[model samples]
Target: MSTSSVVTAPWRLLWRLGLRSSPLALAAPLVRTRPDPDLAPVALRAAGADVAAEPAALESAFPHATDRIVVLVPDTDEDESAWLRHLDQVGGTYASRLAALLDWTPVNVRVSPGEGTAVEVATTLQALVDGWPVPVRRIALIGHGRGGLVLRAACALRHQTPDAWHELVSDVVLLGTPHLAVPAGRTMVPLSRRVDEELAGIVTDDVVDVSAQPLPHARYALITPHTRLQQSRLGGLLGDVLWWRHRLPMRPRKARSLFPSATLHHVPTHEIGLVNHPDVHQAMLAWLA
Candidate 1:
């Protein structure tokens, strides 16, 4: 073996062994800092609702649109305000820049309590869709990270309920979503994977082989970044290996199979912060068109 290969082989072996026997494999729930209760109210307001308001009460805040209704689902552990701010930075406020880009009313949905399993988020989304005051002709869902999984679950729920929301959904956009499984590590994975087996269970149940059971009548798009999870030299190498095995084209390929007509976009970056990238936003706008 070459000198470099000889030196790295032992480390690779150790990593493989660690992953197999690590406590993380047992799927223990990650301990997270308690989110500020105040943030919840802020999130609700950003979504155009009062903290105490019912889902139905928030509907009037969104203008009725015959062209389409666009809903943005933020990443796990993110507040709606953060996403709204991102939207404003990328385009403008929903009524101005986004409205021009999409030619539709854009809405943001806040996942209550701020953090949870995909199923919990999906339940909230279903309620949000059910409570819409205006009829939906065409709907588009844009989700980031675990939010994408929540969108898929919401679609599944719609299938079960036979709602206008499902029938109206024209497309779903997933941004850096880990459809199969994320890289198996604590420091390298996102908050969604750090959650208990709930996240894993949902992904495995819904998308382990989604190509076999794709959502009906809606186009899908998977967008990912070519990013590194680690910065340290040794860690970066390991991260690259894990990323190549887990991230890369794996999730997107699965998505394409699931939705044979699905489109895939790769952003040149080192993280999942695509919301701030104008090119990514433009790509999504193009996809919507």
Candidate 2:
């Protein structure tokens, strides 16, 4: 069949499957994460990395509250070693957590897991600021992968606990994550679905009800590559050309909706090289500013 025919065929199927031509919205419905009891915590001792035992000490080290805040939220299931591995593979030039903190110097805090679902990390942050020296004015959050989703969940929970949010919470920023794909939109569709199935209570319609809140007091900056948009956009334009020649369905933009208050931005991997774009740290800082 002709290349044109191939492109048209899949789009038709997608349309039948409820795909809409209108630009995809950035906001996603409330989604939650389930703890993997089977995945034992890899001893941090083996990884040889220093992880803070106390959440408050971690918050105090960097000053995200006074001026511009950078909160580092890691993937839901990933332990410290996984974070280190990601940094190492990226040539260690930047610590994913540290790099984000440095972008906006006011203060940087790294949120950690605290005895519940990954969402607890956000709750933990709330607990830390019960009576902070300075009230959290503005926030700039940076979450990686599932951690990004956790950030959204954190914001959602604030509504349920207005007093807690008023006390210490501010705003959020997300790193490389796909917000709209809840269970089947894109990016780990099966994973999202599995999470929704097992934990239906939290991952309900309001998980990220962008329409209701419209514009939460936050700025969200997302970095995506067309090639690596799904995985990594390495190689070159020639490679992209070849990919389109053979790859099917015309890669759809897999993105999530940020509240109307957000200033949404994208960094294509072709120019910067896909997969893990190095400039995300800077991009986030500038967006927050």
Candidate 3:
């Protein structure tokens, strides 16, 4: 058979296998994993709600509320409108899968975009939480592509700021994040390596491998899975055609922080692909539950 013919079955087979093995396949009682005892009972503050001055007010309102909020902070302000649109589609797919599997409302929290790199994003999160009456319980910070890199850097930033680590973070999740460096058009290789390597030289913090740091006893981690989405439209259309195959990198990549520990969950590129991968996000939700 031709290479094109070969592509059809292998991906399908992998998808089937994933479905059969996951516990998420069976009905599982998923709930919020991290519950902050110190946080006073309070309601869920609306998005853009005032978490700046009285972040603790949230804790007081939904002390026992499931604080599994998703923070939507993009790393750069560059008008990747096209890319962001694709991400929104993927995010919606992820939300749907979560709803079908666990029936939970997916929370999307947003941090400012273009403010800075991963560290800057984390700094923003810190500032937002510093004044909180109670900190978030089961926090799941998720970003797409470059946003994921920013999220990784933000997790590392949390490690540096011990005070912020007290009750704000739980698990950091990335959707189709690139951890290595790639050329302008290549989709498989990460684009952040050059920057991370450069930063590693200036900062004694060893910021290059931002994924390796341990956060405040939280389960610091990453989510890398395969998807049809590529770095560019042409790449996406080709769909994992050699250079566009997205996966975790070998060197100078985002290291899952030991402070919180990390896990790598690979998904098939088609059928139940990363965006719709049953086990990947569902497993995290299960674990967090």
Top model number, lDDT: 1
Candidate closer to the true structure by TM-score (higher is better), 1 or 3: 1
C-alpha RMSD in Å of predicted model 1 compared with the true structure: 9.8
lDDT of 1 by residue, 153-235 (tens): 55665346666456777878877665553223343554333332232222343333353444678888876543222222232
Tens-digit per-residue lDDT, 101-204, candidate 2: 45433322333333333345544556544433454454455566556655665666543455454233344555445444322333343433332222111222
Which wins on lDDT, candidate 2 or candidate 3? Answer: 3
Q: Name the candidate that leads on TM-score.
A: 1
What's the ranking of the predictions by lDDT, best on top?
1, 3, 2
Worst window of 10 by summed lDDT in candidate 2 = 229-238
Candidate 2: lDDT of 190? 40
Count steric clashes of candidate 3: 27
Q: Write the per-residue lDDT of candidate 3 for residues 209-265, one digit (tens) a residue.
A: 533444555564444433322232222232442332334566332323322345555
Error of 2 at 44 (Å): 14
lDDT of model number 1: 0.51
Model 3 segments beyond 4 Å from truth?
Answer: 1-107, 111-115, 133-135, 158-162, 166-168, 181-221, 226-261, 271-277
lDDT of 3 at 180: 40
